[model samples]
Target: MTAFFFALVASFLAATGARDQLLVAGLRARLGPAPGLLVVALASAVATAFLASWFGAQLSQGMSRDASTMFVALAMLLAAFECIWPNRTPRPQEPTRSLGAIAIVLFLRQLTDASRFLVAAFAVALASPTLAGLGGAIGGGAAVAIGWAAGDALESKVPLRKLRLGLGLILAVLAVWVGLTARGLIG
Candidate 1:
């Protein structure tokens, strides 16, 4: 059950990742549906999910269920906050920010994603972080592929505000659910 929810949310959030849209849109414009770009994006997703999940699994060591639940709840809250807050500017780029290659950029971008945190939390919660990562990798790949396919009309057609609101609401609910389960209020 945890894995299912983790994968569903991970895929949705990853596909709709705010940072990724601009890059994808830019690539679409610059490359015109180039296969190489899509391949890179897919590979990046796999690598990103693998690393994120493994890190989460390691963090889960010695963590009690209640503690894990608390952490997940906190992460979900953070993700909700991200959705509620208006987008902010990136800090002035250190030279480290100027990496080349779409694949590498995409992989690096996942490092700081709220979506990855959710995957990590879910993995720890279910005691299946690596499995959760596998699901996340699949979801991430699918999201990028679908979003890239629709990149051309994404701006005019996609209702981002509504989508964010909906996803945020779901995350909020999950936070509550985790809290309840932690407190022994739910199964």
Candidate 2:
């Protein structure tokens, strides 16, 4: 249950205005909120989270609790850094408007996203990959669903870069705290 909640909240925060959300929202704005697109996005989120959680489970098999906790903190630090980094991927020309293409793109984006990283970290810390994966899937799905539902309004209404920066800073602080606690340097 703790794993589920941690992954859910972490994934949701990490996914806000992320590349995947931007992709879904852009598609919705350009093509309308197609149900097929939403389905594909949800599928991609679930698949990516599950794969990450599985990888975390494998890693946790050999680590002590303290080591797993430290690893989770490291993961959080990585996520924070990722959020702070400037995005340089130029928007590609839409080669096709097919659902399969969209699915592939979304899945690929999630493969390196902060949400998946947090899901994996939580799974390692909690030793509950299934719960972590389910939570991450739901959280990621909700973020994309909002993008689909809001379309251009989401981009126009929200200061996404600011939000990302704020979240990144918070994650960085938490990571430092967690790392210190795991090392018995702080309570």
Displacement of residue 83 (Cα, Å) in model 2 is: 1.5
- On the 0 to 100 scale, the lDDT of residue 149 in model 2 is 93
Q: Write the per-residue lDDT of candidate 2 for residues 53-158, one digit (tens) a residue.
A: 9999999999998999999999999999888876566544563579998898999999889999999999999999999999999999899999889987987899
By lDDT, the best candidate is 2
lDDT for model 2: 0.90
lDDT of 1: 0.69
What's the lDDT for residue 59 in model 1? 75
Worst 10 residues of 2 by lDDT: 87-96
Taking all chains together, each candidate's TM-score versus the true structure is 0.80, 0.95
The per-residue C-alpha lDDT of model 1 at residue 28 equals: 60
Number of colliding residue pairs in model 2: 0
**Candidate 1 local Cα displacement, residue 103, angstroms:** 2.5
Clash-forming residue pairs, model 2: none
- Best-fitting candidate, measured by TM-score? 2
